[model samples]
Target: MAGRVVRPRQLAFALSHTESLTRDNFLEGPSNETALALIDSWPDWPNRIMLLSGPEGSGKSHLATIWAEQAGARAISAHSLIDTMVPDTLVTGALVIEDLIPGTFDERALFHLMNMAREDEAYVLITARVAPASFAIPLRDLNSRLRAVPVVTVAAPDDQLFRALIVKLCSDRQMTVDESLVSYLATRIERSVAAARRVVAELDAESLRLRRPVTRALAVEVLRDSA
Candidate 1:
């Protein structure tokens, strides 16, 4: 039987579902090993309060979501934390805040929320691309408090890890790729997981459009235009 053609929205949903957060879905490598170890030690942590920080596409948010699933923790986006009061939004266990370094001016509220979570003996994990020190935080108290929390940074992936990530992403998308092609991309594309991911996504979309399998030629063409 012929498989049904995936519409754009359907493809989007499929990709989202396949890439949904789990420790297994997170590609393990030297760069992220420390963060994974820290997350794995979550069971031993007295305060589930942890912070994961790294460059873009370093999988900080992905690991945060894994932490939530493993500990039955609540994951909340940054926008929600700003627009809504903490007590009103989070009434129970752990909470995660993503993108805490950029325009994160609502420090007083976050400071109070941290105390509340501590009082309740619940965990709070904040994930960001950069460390809190890089932000323009005016609250001295909050700055000191945030600094005390253990922060784990995900280093950029190396060539091997990048190749593995590309293959994993393609597999998750149910797309077949040749090893030689992955090798070509690993050497040619930008040296960031974010770049590899974007290239794969573009190739996937292009393949769907042209009804062709992704090859070295196609990859090169797509990357050149995008780069």
Candidate 2:
């Protein structure tokens, strides 16, 4: 699955986690502990550039934000990378450009940004579901730079992240459920971030239609329907 691409909704599902970028809330497990460590080892980055790659709902954006805040990095999207002097305007040496689509990115601007970052000993962190190798960057120099940058990937949500996601998604809707219910969902639901969010949203609608409280029974029925 090298250089794989995914849908936008898949990436947005990553953002379904709590809005807080506090490091304390970032759950650590075998799955993402390495990626977290790489971020924690920042400023000491080999090339002062890092690429945070992960599947949708893998919490890459959240981790990027945490790193950005700590390193005083300016954050922007790949789409906005072009048509603006955003990169040149960055006062700090650190930059975070997310959602890096290969063909769509502004080759010149991104190339300049990366070049400047290297020359100034600044840092850049990019987040995306797609691999940098998969991007069709036109600028030869930019392509070479991205190819050499470190791409630390966060794996799909682990069991701990799944359970945490269930709680987070429910909390987003102000719905309460027992731990047992969350555990049940963590086991039964699809092992993807999109599944976590979609199920929670569906549960709300299902409960409303049935005029019932969200319960193990309701979840069972909802999952069945979704299946």
Candidate 3:
């Protein structure tokens, strides 16, 4: 008992960090160029309604925030759509409906919103994980309207962007990581922004738990244990 090595108990701390969603904080890369361009085009868009499609954590929300700021748009989740609130939601002449999952939101409310937006010449930006055209909407008219909207897909990040994302994610957590850790993670983890965020969070938590710095060795163990 006297020679036993005591391990530090891992305490869960609610670490708070602010992620900048401003336009200046956005990282530009080829994977999201079209999506970013669409947001920048703003009132000059070809259509009053458009859709942004990408996987989870693909910066769809961030782009929506940027467009919302520029266009003076109010942001709301698709699930909150009520027929009665459509008018007030579009008071700014622009609106962003985020995380629209197929068959989850009310069809009538969406249809009414689209019709009113058309009549009022208001802009609507819908963010979904997949193209809205692929959604199996029960309302034929609503399906037709969704099919007509232009869609921009955010592809997975490229190598340069992937590495940069890992670094940025670490910075967001206030972790002091060098190029060695960044390069090691780039090779070990999946090449996606979401994956980068997840691994960084894991590394931070593990480092805190083990009372060690975020070195390549810690990353190797964290990744191995996670895998």
Q: Indicate which candidate wins on lDDT.
A: 3
> Model 2, which residues run further than 4 Å from truth?
1-18, 205-211
Q: Write down the RMSD of all candidates, one decimal each.
A: 6.5, 10.1, 1.9
Candidate 2 per-residue lDDT over residues 8-69, each given as its tens digit: 53111223434455677676766788889988988777667888888887778778888988
lDDT of each structure? 0.79, 0.79, 0.91
User: Model 3 misses residue 184 by how many Å?
Assistant: 1.5
**Two-way lDDT contest, 2 vs 3, winner:** 3
Residue pairs with backbone atoms closer than 3 Å in model 3 (clashes):
none
The better candidate by lDDT, 1 or 3, is 3
Please give me the total number of clashing residue pairs in predicted model 2: 1
Per-model clash counts, in order, read: 0, 1, 0
For model 3, residues 1-53, the per-residue Cα lDDT tens digits are 58879987888575888777899889989999999999998889989999999
* Candidate 1 lDDT, 1-227, residue by residue in tens: 99999876423222452664677678888999999888888877745577788998888888888888887777777745653577754565778787776564477778888888777777888888877666666778878878777788998998788888899888878889998889999998888878888888888888877777888888988988887
In candidate 1, list every pair of residues with a backbone clash: none
After best superposition, candidate 2 residue 159: deviation in angstroms?
A: 2.5
Model 3 clash number:
0
Q: Which candidate gets the maximum TM-score versus the true structure? A: 3
